[model samples]
Target: MAASPDTLARVEELTARRLNRTLLARQHLLARSTQTAHDLIHHLVAVQAQESNAPYISLWTRLEAFEKDDLTALLADRRAVRSSILRGTQHIATDDDYPWLRPTVQPVLDRGRQGAFGRVTAGVDPVELAALARKHLTGQTLTRPALARLLAERWPDVEPLALGWSAQCLLPVVHPPPSGTWGRFGATPFVLAEEWLGRPMAAPDAERLVVRYLAAFGPGSARDVQAWSGLTRLREVLERLPLRRYRTPAGVVLYDLPDAPLADEDAPAPVRLVPEFDNLLLAHADRTRVIADAHRRVVITGAVVRPTFLVDGFVRGMWSMTGAGIVLAPFEAITEAARDALTREAAELLRFAGTEGSVSFTAPGH
Candidate 1:
């Protein structure tokens, strides 16, 4: 049956409320059958805390009282780890979970190395290169350059930069402190993930991961999952799952866990200031979930994605604060209610930044 547009709109509203709360809410309810956005953000906060400092900031803007060290303590306990996840980018995840997540993402690293790094390390012996890295990094932490130098001696034909990427991407490695150390100063140092985490990377299970994502960010199309994970052929996995499917107004079919709650279409939404690289903006194939296409230019310019604000679940504009104060440029004219909410949100951000920054607004035509 074609999903009703009304049902889709209801789902969007409810999901926006859930996502508007941010990562803290997203992670909390990921494991539960019927989860709220708050619960999901709570869980994301908990998992993000595995890295500690930044995750707290990541949650603070989204949540109510995310302290700086809330996440620090988590990392100190080995409950979480910072490693490459989907799309081969760094994410702080539970140590218990990283083993499984890391291997699942290895294909990205593998593909990148062959397509990009392969040109550089064309003649280099994979076994020998891995051995060189193991030898250099055993019991000692080496920054990307230090590791590069060690390998460069053996594989002079390889570009040092390419060598660094290949080392981290092609092999099972961990970027240890003072890379992620709180307020510490140093470059990224390479160590084996197994050595640092005390366990080997787990085998890949595309199906379970897909299900997990759908549970957290579901009522979404298979393309959304692929967009989030950079994984392809997920349609097969989605089809196998016991999921309830629907179609958006655009006729794109979507899937979600059967009992997952969809946000109320008319739910009152808060103005939210999302951090750079916040998954809310990046989680879907079609971002109509939280943003409009015309406003895309305001948030994304070429490869740079700016911090954005959501008013009534739609991205009204982009924002930035400088010495002058908070500057908001809207792609569309916002209402007085939106302006008031944005003003309040901006003030909160200023307080977080530890200063009283003024606010300014710029409309496109004016």
Candidate 2:
């Protein structure tokens, strides 16, 4: 006989529970790791920022010995930078990452600006405008309004908001420190990422980026990556990657690195308080792994991503800082033991925040 037509079986299946714990471990949510702030930022690729103090708290919640000074030093020293990239939102990324990250995501920003802001900035040469924007921002830090007003002087006919937002969308800009400092609010300043970091923007390499996404948030589908990054048409990139593929019992294809960690289905998941816009919660197309179907809308609104906590590697509820203390609102009731764990962690968070805050709870569905 020539040969058996049937080949050896392939690819392990990943249950939602296993997926949850694996992701938690990769993100350092199960337990705080000792990775330096710079290394963590580089590994995670970026932290969802723009909300002051979110980045600092994010590091604190994920790094064992994290302190405010750890992150503040990176921003002050320019080893890291804050800028708009994935999904065109403000994020803090290391100098090593942004060069490649910014170029890769430029098309996403272009599409967003063209579809939304371009309607108002119609007929403006974006190429020329980008050049002018870079020129205006070179060796200078200008707030949005100031930069807008200056650019508007030349194109007085265009809406100043459009002109300003165009520069924001089109440029690889950084809002340096004292800007992201907790509780400090004023003019939001911008500088070119290349100038601030002294590294040129890297060429777009979609293949490598797909691998990075897999490393950080993987065993996920292309749609998950698209949902996380807000970049579309990534199927080609995913297809080209040398990925180890798996499927859920439901048959959803999941991709991963050949050696990526996939934890046991029964692994324990500790409670972790994450800041608003935590990328872990935002990284999947099917987030039922980390969030329930009914509770998703409650966590995210139009532009606001609420701070949330994970119980057993899933978003058990939401939390917030109030005048009196940290408030925990569970979507479902928890055991006394879980409640006690949350209370202890809340105190740690309060101390990290330099607050005399206490923990308060509300009934499920309240």
Candidate 3:
């Protein structure tokens, strides 16, 4: 029998460059893999999906045979869903996974909701609110405002908007198909996840989840996992895992599954255009692994996650779908040949978005 990955290799030192390549490879960013959208969602745990079409664009950059409908079909087939998961935001999770992952992240969601809308919902019984939300939303899809109005009748004392936002935060609800479908903005209608899927949400399991995160995003510290997941005290979980461990060039300790592969430090990574809120950028607390300090704030300014692209496994520029055309604003200059390659990739990205767009650029230095 093969030795366990934990036992086979002693932990090795990793440089930032080596860490970046390993991250890209595990994330399927080093090369486009041929996995279907459904399989990819499960493997990655969740893909950041705040925008209506961002998940589709993300899959396009990571999968070879990915089609817009491949993800659409997963949603239609109830094989996948978009709901609040990690860090209290929308993510695409498989049908079998969301139930447990949802409950696991509830505290994070609760913390965010309480901070955002809790003052208005003060003294409200969350249990009662969640039950009423389930009752009102079961077997029906309703927008936030409309559902707020319905819920307000029950708690007329509470502000309807607060109630609506609270229901969203507290319940395991999903925005229905047309809402997250590519190139569409159907009313942000929501329904109970349990009712829609004909299955109950499984209980949260932090140990298993931590292990999975290590499998995908690891050789990472507990802080990194918490950054990706928004839960805390994960160092306690990492302490118990039977995995190899390493320290980065910065001397930060990281842990990983015993058998996980570490590519050579100088591994090649192609340029990849990612949509707003891409998990690669959002998942790690120490984002220097993929994004430099100078550009991090601009990439994720308050409530504005500008689109970004990865060149050689690290973020190099911002992009947009402006009316004039597809635009790239690089923070630094690149070779003319590199510019040519970026242009071709941007053109393909435009086509994937179902728009005919000319690629444009904002040269370095204004």
RMSD (Å) per prediction: 5.3, 3.2, 3.8
TM-score of each: 0.82, 0.96, 0.94
Q: List the residue pairs that clash in candidate 2.
A: none
Q: After best superposition, candidate 3 residue 197: deviation in angstroms?
A: 1.3
Q: Total clashing residue pairs per candidate?
A: 18, 0, 2
Give residue 181's error in model 2 in angstroms: 2.3
Model 1, which residues run further than 4 Å from truth?
Answer: 1-57, 181-186, 323-325, 363-366
1 versus 3: better lDDT goes to: 3
Summarize candidate 1's per-residue lDDT along 1-366 as a digit string, tens digits: 445676665543334434433322342311122432234343442222223233444555655554445555555655665666666666667666677877887888777678877876889877777777887877777888888988888878778888877888766776664467455545576778788888877789998787778666666777898887877888888888888766654557778778766554555566777655666667787776677776765577774567677776667777877776788777778889888878887887776655566988987533
lDDT of all the models against the reference? 0.66, 0.86, 0.85
Q: What TM-score number comes out for model 3?
A: 0.94
Query: By descending TM-score, how would the candidates be arranged?
Result: 2, 3, 1
Clashes of 1: 18
